[model samples]
Target: MAVHHQASIVPTKAELLAAWVPRQPWAAGADTSSLTKLGSYRFDDPDGEVGMETHVLATADGQVLQVPLTYRGAPRAGAEESLVTTMTHTTLGDRWIYDALHDPVYAAVLASTIATGGHEADLFLSTPDGLVLQPASARVRGSGTAPSAPAAGWSGPRVTVAGTTSRIECDGALLTVLHVLETTTASAAADELVLTGTWLGQDRPVLLAVLR
Candidate 1:
């Protein structure tokens, strides 16, 4: 389970996105002015050194995009160019945020979630009343089980299909994430499609990634 805080984050997620997203090739024609969040999901790092989250966003004209992000205590080594920005969390101190593909924590959790047929973790709150369940954000489901999450120290083997870049670990199985997902143009070819969930007012099962 994940514990969320009511603390504020400096610069805010939207501010950072507005500055960095337009430059990405996949977001080339997005209408930033009217961008709306469709929903989001999260993954937990067993070691607890990082935070992993994927937000589904929608453009004014009806384009859906999947953006995965990783939060860390320090800047990712050798990945300066991918840094989205640095922010101070009211409760967690300063944090370094990066596009998920450049962070190993994201790679590991994503691979494991799909391989083990996992789902977005439940959320809870710690208070005087003890642990209380929080309202779920988005609902998601994963499939298959083989390309287990690599060991903690493993960085990643990032890949790109079509125009989307992904972080994957394909040993005995395949677990890959299409960083900038364009559902309208995604190819329906894969060993097994995994990870589907619900969005606000939408119940269609969207394929998050391809697993084999």
Candidate 2:
């Protein structure tokens, strides 16, 4: 038998968020064009080749936002529009930065990490090639339909509630909520969560939630 191996590259906490925050649509003060990082942490990826980073940034106007960034070797095919921004890592040298949400492989890794404690429901989207589902560990209290198939060109996963629908996507270490019908009603609550891993240079716990 033969074994294959690959090199791993990880970025520092500052480097991770510095490359991440400005790209987010929800990022406040983004339009002003100046950014200052307040704090940051990392999410665990057992395979170090992929790096997940969470950052707290302060805008010139004093608004703060949490941004998560995932670093990958290459860009996902056909997702150039979803690509947020690209920058070089100081420690890693010349590798390119990629947004994880657009990449199915990284999404699977994130979903698997989240699905550890609870049972994974089968409400995922399917393609002729395979199925892509968001990993949910909470108990489904009521009956609801699964999400619709992923859309083409900058479309994200569909999550429905009552008669309304929303789109969910992950970017790097941060999860993005879009097309929300009602903002007040959309939220995430977890019983208990832990920060058991680290990415970039910060520590990350499993209970992290991105609420709209």
Candidate 3:
């Protein structure tokens, strides 16, 4: 059977940082301030539909910060209001926006992409709750299948950490790292991946790892 790859559409590094920096919690400028783009690079998302871009920006203050962004179809359901300034409405009405700290999908893809080709990296798992983690193993399965939906349950490999099974989920620019702590624990219990770097939204060199 032939495998179909989803199309990935991402803004250029310059475009991404131009749009991203202002939305960060630590952004220096006022809402009306202008930003200069420094550089950017792409991270691997198994499913091409969801594109992940890391952007670096230099503010008017001369301070640089890295901001990681996940571009998706449109504003998330209840996030419409938060979309006010963060979203850049597309022709398709597919709003490109900033989902800062807790976006699960982006984190998952970033982790998987970074883990690829690295020794001692086992499996990249995304749980239904949106957690992405690399389990220690010699051979991992489904590394080729990038997650497309948040609700799709875990279907690849069997990883038992501390007697808990885990999965990783990546949606657009968010990555979810999940650990199935116990049957009683909520299915969605997981940690978030936040982007921190020299320049706002820049993930080059080393994607500064911050556990949120």
Candidate 4:
């Protein structure tokens, strides 16, 4: 489960994205000031130390993009290049944010989720009274079945961006995130496992990632 505290954050998520996203290679020339969050989903960290989430945003021009993020209490060593920004939380104090593509925790969870045909974690809102179940705006599912053996170990993800996609590889697992959502893409091979999602307006599943 993913628990969200009912607290305020300085430099709110939208504000942070506005300042940082426009500079990304895939989002270059994007007017992020008007970026609209279409939906989001969460993946749980087994250790429960870091928060993992992926947000889908639509540009002013109607280009859809996916951004995966990880939140930490302190800076991650050797991950300076992936650091997105920092923020102050009313209840959690200072927080560090990094692109999830560079976070090992995210890679491990994503790999496991895909290998096991898993769905996004259940969302829960932490309140003074207790925890309340919250509905997820976006829903995602992996296409693989249980694996017989564990994947080979890899240190972290090596990411490369092309025209409209980002390729991420780690621990012998290759993942391709479609930064720009397109419905006319070629069909996936029968053997390839993929991650697909649906949101409010989009009832048809949209290809989000492919695990090769």
Q: Residue 109 of candidate 3: its Cα lDDT?
A: 46
lDDT of 2 at 28: 35
Encode model 4's per-residue lDDT on 98-210: one tens digit a residue.
98887878877777777788889999999889999999899998888886323744466788887677787866678777777864443578898888888878888888888
Q: What is the alpha-carbon lDDT for the whole of candidate 3?
A: 0.37
The candidates, ranked best first by TM-score, are: 4, 1, 2, 3
Best by TM-score: 4
How much lDDT does each candidate structure score?
A: 0.71, 0.39, 0.37, 0.83
Which whole-number lDDT from 0 to 100 does residue 93 have in model 1? 92
What would the TM-scores of all predictions be?
0.83, 0.45, 0.42, 0.93
Instruction: Residues 133-184, candidate 3: write the lDDT tens digits.
Output: 5422111112223334234223321222221112233322223322111112
Q: Which segments of model 2 are wrong by more than 4 Å?
A: 1-24, 28-32, 89-91, 113-212
Better of 3 and 4 by TM-score: 4
lDDT of 2 at 59: 61
lDDT of model 1 at residue 176? 62
lDDT of 2 by residue, 1-212 (tens): 11111223355445555555554544532432555564444444545565554444556565444444566656656767555555554444545455544555444443443434322223344445565653322221211122421122223433222211123443422333221112123234453211122223233222233322
Overall local distance difference test of candidate 1: 0.71
Q: Report the error of model 4 at residue 20, Å.
A: 1.4
